[model samples]
Target: MSELKILIVDDDPVTRSMLKHTLNAHGYLTAEASDGADALAKMAAETFPIVISDWNMPNMNGLELCEQIRKHDSEGYIYTILLTSNNAMEDRVKGLRAGADDFIGKPFNKDELLERMAAGERVLNLETREALIFALAKLAESRDTDTGLHLERVQRYARFLTQELVGDPAFADEIDEEFIQLVYQTSPLHDIGKVGIPDSVLLHPGKLSKDQFKLMQSHTVIGADCLKGAIAKSPKAKFLHMAHDIARFHHEKFDGSGYPDGLVGEKIPLAARIVAIADVYDALRSRRIYKPAFSHERSCEIICGDAGSHFDPRLVAAFERVHEQFATIAERFSEPSELPGSAEPKELEMVH
Candidate 1:
């Protein structure tokens, strides 16, 4: 692997010299900036994965520099490590609040600096991988679900479900903020492999034949393969790989009754299992060529009946709490075919 480019921003020449020598000896390439202005200029010229900057400088100090970096880009993350002579609690808090990835006390230990920089590198790599994964997810959604709104609605439903679960004491730690946000953003890709399924099956107006049902099931494998292929190209993308697991296993049931793989109970990945309930609920309540949409109440009844039989009981409980949000989502994204008098199902209310 090529050496990571490190940018040093310290007014003191001696400190820069020592850092450069220490980092070079450890096989990292170094760049120097006497002040924040120079550092920002250098940053614009070339992308440096890690920046070690002294907290106090003439103009555009390290804290300001970190804030500016945070504002400027969306594609790549720049890790800023602040060097501080000030040991005040407020000073450290300010630096972190301004976006410095780490703050090192003045007279920083060489080994500690190296360790912190390594940690910063890990964070930057993770950010880059996430960007790539999200891009691929967008591509997958665009290809399969023709309407641009499908992804939005699915993600919204996932977020609502996750938020409801996180609020409950039982799932607070398990569905932390990061996991909830990731699942909310990536859950829409569950149907990505529908792109690979023939339109004849995907757009059929009636129930699928046994043979066609078998073929339709291949979408899970196909979607997983697409993401696996993406990971083969970019091995650092861990979240994309997680999304692949969701796409492949979301259909698997809690009672060993679902498609592709019949994973049962906790055997299914938690994220995938959560997504399965959300996906089926949305699919049932949304209009599709094969069937008219079900009423929100009937959809809830169907899902409630399947607790522990087709879904995780805990998630089903969560779903029950947030079922109203699902109705809101249906109202927001109901297709034209699902509008009033459009092949009205017998049991559904004709909500005008």
Candidate 2:
């Protein structure tokens, strides 16, 4: 019901102003771009729910901009409306083929345009809510510099494990598709508490001393507290509750030796247990400032060796069943190899 942010891209100043004022009068926040190139620039710098672009422009055409927006794999979806003076049916079909969502012919009707904009706003609201939720998980990934890609890779691995568990005789009855997805999406926040941990301990180049290690272990509690605070504000945030359990207990050991709360065996949350194995495996295989990366075979050996002690034996068995899936995730997000002092972050933008 609030104002929807809409971008108007047109080469003619008169047309752009008319559309902006018309849309703004209907309770929409407006942004304007003179050409397709400027529109793309705005698209990168900010988030817009819908783009109303003119077909003909100086640099790139509306169709080209539509194609570019389609290619970006990100959180929010951009509903594009191409403005064209051509009224031919073939031109409209071509525009749709080129990725235009809804086309408005030039000499557009104010009422028709408003109706289309309303529908686009409804679709965008759902996308915006989903984007906000995923953004929180991204924040967890941001805190741990060395744990880069752990949040991403583990989600894929968790999905695979959960999917398999849903078919297993022991877990099939309790594990449903919805439960699996919620766990997959929310599991990455398992280490969200690390945000509260000091960089001296988190970014230390070597193993932590006894006290430092104990202090480092408190991140689980901190993460849970932070997630609890968020849920306190919005009780409808069911995912946050799931994330709280995972964050608080992911470090717990199967043999009851892990930190914060030494939960044993099946006593720990299943979501936490699943993430624990995947986290450790990804951590061992990925490069970090403190330790060198280990090979897949060696990391697998360590995981299987510590099965009864470090992880739940049943979950470890589930992991072995989906080891290939883990390998795929690792290879997909694998860190580039670089010699000492020669590494640089591959110029990747903060997406979503």
Candidate 3:
């Protein structure tokens, strides 16, 4: 899609015309509406990513318009800005409660309006980046038919374990709700380096030789190295930094024996450690060319037995606490070939 279109709504023709002209001069494609009702009618026929509405319009006011937009489904964020004369705290609270993103006081300068819109555009860009990241991860996973829903399952499992860790005294400082959600989004990219691997190796139906296995293991470093340049350029992008850590260290073991890096115990980044068990558990339960599907009981035993070896003991304990959630996710997002152990099999979609 090209740049998103904006909707301008106001009861006064003068105010609506001024906004339309000003935004168009700023290079924004805009559509004008006489009032909130007209704006909603236009929205029903077409999508508007941003809605700029006057606070007091007849038939349907801006507050009601904002609330209605919030209740409607949108493919992307529909940021609403209210043009209001009131600068009082109570009015601001009411506008926010009614779902407005920001309030632009009446008689506002062009610079102020443009600045607010620029901030809103930045948020929309971030959401676009996240969606593209997920799509790219899915593209990488799609190469191997056996890997159906692997990315979704691991991210969900990782999210569950990370969420549980947020309350533990050991991880309270490092794990929070935002961090858990980031793990859910970035975990899918852990194996994104597989995109660089050859079809012959990736689609093989048998075990790879030692050299091929070495080539396969390079996916970790390959993914990390690729993300390093991205992090250097963005510097402040926390998601890229976490992605780099996860892509590089997810294969590293708790004991100093696993591949790519011999990171042991607390030496491994916490996010990588959390995803390690998630990836392992999902691989064990899901059928693959190299291994038959292991029963849930056997899979759990392997994970529990490897505590302090294949995974962090604390995360293992976290896993023990949320294993049922993991099992539910596994059954819900099983391979396409496997019968969905749940009543509904779902494809994960972005929530804008």
Please name the candidate that would achieve the greatest lDDT relative to the true structure. Answer: 3
Query: Which parts of model 2 have CA positions greater than 4 angstroms off?
Result: 1-130, 337-352
Residues 1-352, model 3: lDDT tens digits: 2355899999888888888878888788899898888998999998888899999989999999986775443556677899999789768756764667787989868889998889778656666676877898898888888877888788778866775665466876786545765787799899989988998887767667677777888989989998999998999988999999999999888997886878788889999999899998887777676555666776788789888877888889888977887877778677566542321111110000
User: Which residue pairs in candidate 2 collide?
Assistant: 193-223
RMSD of 1: 10.0
Tens digit of lDDT per residue, candidate 2, span 141-230? 676656666676777677666655644556646565446657766776777777788888877776568888788889899989988888
For model 2, what is the error of residue 76's alpha carbon versus the real structure, in angstroms, after optimal superposition?
9.7
| Model 2 lDDT, residue 257, Cα | 88
lDDT of 2 at 344: 26
- Screening candidate 3 with a backbone cut-off below 3 angstroms (N, C-alpha, C), the clashing residue pairs are none
lDDT of each: 0.75, 0.74, 0.79
Overall local distance difference test of candidate 3: 0.79
Tens-digit per-residue lDDT, 223-342, candidate 1 = 999889878988886567668889999989899988778888888887888888777776667665545667788778878888988889998887897787678776766667664223
Backbone clash pairs for candidate 1 read none
User: Model 1: residues >4 Å from true position, as ranges?
Assistant: 1-148, 167-173, 340-352
User: What overall lDDT, based on C-alpha atoms, would model 2 receive against the true structure?
Assistant: 0.74
